[model samples]
Target: MTYETILLAKENGVATITLNRPPMNPLNSQLFKELGHAVDEIAEDNSIKVLIITGSGSKAFAAGADVSEMAYLSPVEVYNFNMGSRKTFDKIENLGKPVIAAIAGITFGGGCELALACDFRFAAENVKIAFPETGLGIIPGGGGTVRLPRLIGVGRAKELIYGGEMIDAVTAEKLGIVTKVVAVDVLMEEAQNYAAKLAVRPSVAMKMAKESIQAGVNLDSSSALNYENQCFITAFASEDAKEGLGAFLEKRKPNYTGK
Candidate 1:
């Protein structure tokens, strides 16, 4: 499928979706719709084991939502727009396969929220991340309020969101928001290498593990354990599991078919 706001590429079990708008890839309704379509395509492709999301230029992964678009919107229209964005981000978070955010430059508001949806975030040394919505007299309407607090504790989340302060990549890593920080030149390379490594793992087991972890986040200890056990059973029943066990006994590498 064709997209105007994003570019999609697939190879070697890894798919990349690049936000094409340069300088500052502002999330507008058109971009959101295109992103949703790209995500859906990646989710349905069995050969694509992992996804990496990034922006076109080094200037920004994304700056924020298109304020120009939102400025003229009525309360009802803005609410609907935000709801659509929330749904798209939710899809990214629950994409079944691992998703990595290769972030650089400015990441604010909806941009920061989009990165939060990914399973891993690898930021460049030049990256600056924040949720500066409060400064705009608005709050994060793209799952930022919900996911950020859950990720880095309420205190730190509040510090970033409420203060509307931008933190460097290292600071974000120290706060547990960024998985790793790399040189700006090697950011995409590092992310792609990591994605390649994950793509080679047993797909069924990986998917189940991802699902278990995500589900456990909202579940109680006892219920989470039960759900994890169920996920384990499901993974254990896959053909890859049998091959993995046989390979272990035979002292050979396992060949996974993603079954």
Candidate 2:
């Protein structure tokens, strides 16, 4: 499918969606629309096992939401826009396959929320992450207020959101917001390598594990444990699981066809 605000590319079981709106790649209504379409395509394409999200230019993964598009919007328009953003983020979070955010330069406001929706994030050493909406007299209308705290804890999330300060890559890593920090030039390469690694795992097991984790997060310990055990049993029934066991017994590498 054609995309105006993003670029989609697939190679070797990995798909990448690059935020293409130049220097800052600010999020807008059109960008959100294109993202929804792109994500839906990715979900339907079995050839794509992993998705890496990043920005085109060196300046930003995404600076923030396009304030110009939102500044004068009616209250109802604003509500609809926020819901669209939320839906896009939820799609990424629940994509079944792993979604990795390859963050560079500035990732603020909605951009930070976008990364949080991913299973994990990798950032360049120069990347700056922030949740600066409170300073603008508005709270994070997207999933930032929800996902950020669940990721980095309430205190840290509050510190970032309330202070509205841009934290560097090292600081973000320290806060557990990003998975790892890499040299700028190797950021994309590293992220792709990680995706390639994930793509080779048993697909059914991976999906089940992801589902269990996402669901388990909101459940009580007893219920979560029970659900995890059910997921384990379900994965054990897959052909890949049998192959894995057989290969282990035979002392050979398993050939997983994502069954």
Candidate 3:
């Protein structure tokens, strides 16, 4: 499908989605809606093993939601917008597969939240990340309040959100916001290399592991273990599990069909 605000492509078992509104791609309503559509497509397609999301240009991942779009929104409209973005982020978070955010430039406000939604993140040394919503007399409405704390802990999340301060990729990695920070020239190479490795693993185990971890986040100790056990047992019934055991006994590599 043709997209006005984004670019979508599939290659090397990876689906790459780029936010194309250059010069600090501000998230206008149209861009947000188009993002929803693009994300939905990636989620529904079975051929996509891993999803990589990033922004065009080297200046910004996304500046923030377009301020022009914000000025006229009623309180209810704002509420609806939050719900939409939350739903979209949730889809990526619980996509039943892998999604990685390749943060190349600036990641602020909605952009930071979007990256947080991904299962993993890779940032370049040139990248900057923050939740500066409070600077605008607002708050991070797109799961930043919920997910950021989960990713990087409450104290640090509060500092960034409340202070409206930006952190470079090095600090972000220290805080666990980004898994790795590399040079800009190797950003895509590193991200794709990771994706390629993930694609060859047991797909069923990966899916179940993702669900177990995400669902366990909100559950108690016993419940979390129970959920984890269920995922493990389910995998035992999969063909991939048989292949894995057989290959182990044969002292050979296992080939998974994603079954």
Top candidate, metric TM-score: 1
User: 1-259 in candidate 2: lDDT tens per residue?
Assistant: 5789999999999999999999899999899989988999998888888999999977999988999999999999999898889899899999989999999999999999899999989999999988889889999877988998998899988888899988999999999999999999999999999999999998889989999999999999999999999999999999999999999999999999877
Could you give candidate 1's per-residue lDDT for residues 1-259 as a string of tens digits? 6799999999999999999988899999889999999999999999999999999999999998999999889999998899879889999999999999999999999999999999999999999998888988889999999999999999989899999998999999999999999999999999999999999999999999999999999999999999999999999999999999999999999999999
Task: For model 1, name the residue pairs that clash.
Answer: none
Look at candidate 3 and tell me the lDDT of residue 237: 89
Which stretches of model 3 miss by more than 4 angstroms?
none
Q: List the residue pairs that clash in candidate 2.
A: none
lDDT of 3 by residue, 56-81 (tens): 98788887777787778899987877
TM-score of 2: 0.98
CA shift of 129, model 1, Å = 0.9
Of candidate 1, the 10-residue stretch with the lowest lDDT total is 79-88
Off by over 4 Å in 2: none
Give the lDDT ranking, best first. 1, 2, 3
